[model samples]
Target: MKVTESPSYSTPEVSKVMDQSRRFIATASDRPEDIVEKADTEIIGLALQMLSDGTADQVIIVTNDIPLGEAAESLIPKYGFTADQVTWLTGGELAPELKEDFVSEFD
Candidate 1:
């Protein structure tokens, strides 16, 4: 339940994480040429930073963006986290009760 701002993009660590995330997204695509860019790099960079800095052992990136989730899943291991330690939850996959609450709050 902790909320924190994304790490500054100017930091070398954040920049590195963002580059890694973009590369992962491009590689995972069927049409790498069609992939323009990842707008969620900042979020992905922050998540990686938490794991890298020992701020969190596990991170669950809940989002409706499929590419964002895929990149996070693919790169988490490079940040020293196992697949089990990272989770990606799409909005549709949330439990029914929680889904309603989550949607309502956002709406």
Candidate 2:
């Protein structure tokens, strides 16, 4: 979805978070021209917004995308959130029980 189409994007805080995520991804990527995807950034942006708005004490981002996870980790601290305040998990790192459930759902 376009960033503007996000229901939460109408809020100033969400909008700011989204912009930060986009900028970070652009500058951080080696191939800046190839990093045009915004969905992953939007997910990170919403997670950051929740932390900023006090909606969540901590946020855990579970994704197989390594770059996206790294981006979230790097950007979290820039927004005044500490490492302990957020967790990034890859599919391989998921607990056995969650992995079973995850697989079952897709199957």
Candidate 3:
């Protein structure tokens, strides 16, 4: 589980959470089907809407509480987005490998 913040988390906070998740994933080998008892259905619909309406270049996180992957996946057919449209928010692990303007100023 990730600890998200309102108004979004900073790069440092995101890094911290990702690091902890790596440790947890390494230690606890649990299946998502059995792990998550109550799923957030609202998020799925919301994400789908955002994905359909929002541009691929933009990340529209309406409620910061929603998981990034969950939110992105919900978009699916809305905007014709594949895994390529979404990038894991890696602090710096693959920054050198990125070709898109993920951190660039938007118009």
Candidate 3 lDDT tens digits, 3-104: 332312243433333333333333333325333312233333333334444523434333222243443444333445666554334333445445353362
For model 1, residues 1-107, the per-residue Cα lDDT tens digits are 45888676776777887887777666655445335354577778888778777888888888866667888888767766799878999776766555664542112
The per-residue C-alpha lDDT of model 1 at residue 14 equals: 72
Worst 10 residues of 3 by lDDT: 1-10
TM-score ranking of the models: 1, 2, 3
Residue-level lDDT tens digits of model 2 in 1-107: 12323327777766776666677666655446346477877888788777787878898888766667777887777788999987999776776565554542111
> What's the CA RMSD for each of the models?
5.4, 6.6, 13.6
RMSD of 1: 5.4
**TM-scores, in order shown?**
0.70, 0.67, 0.27
Q: Which stretches of candidate 2 lie over 4 Å from their true place?
A: 1-7, 10-13, 27-29, 33-35, 95-107
Instruction: Quote the positional error of residue 4 for candidate 2 in Å.
Output: 16
Cα error, residue 56 of model 3, in Å, equals: 7.5
CA lDDT of each candidate?
Answer: 0.73, 0.70, 0.36
Q: Which 10 successive residues of model 2 have the least lDDT summed?
A: 98-107
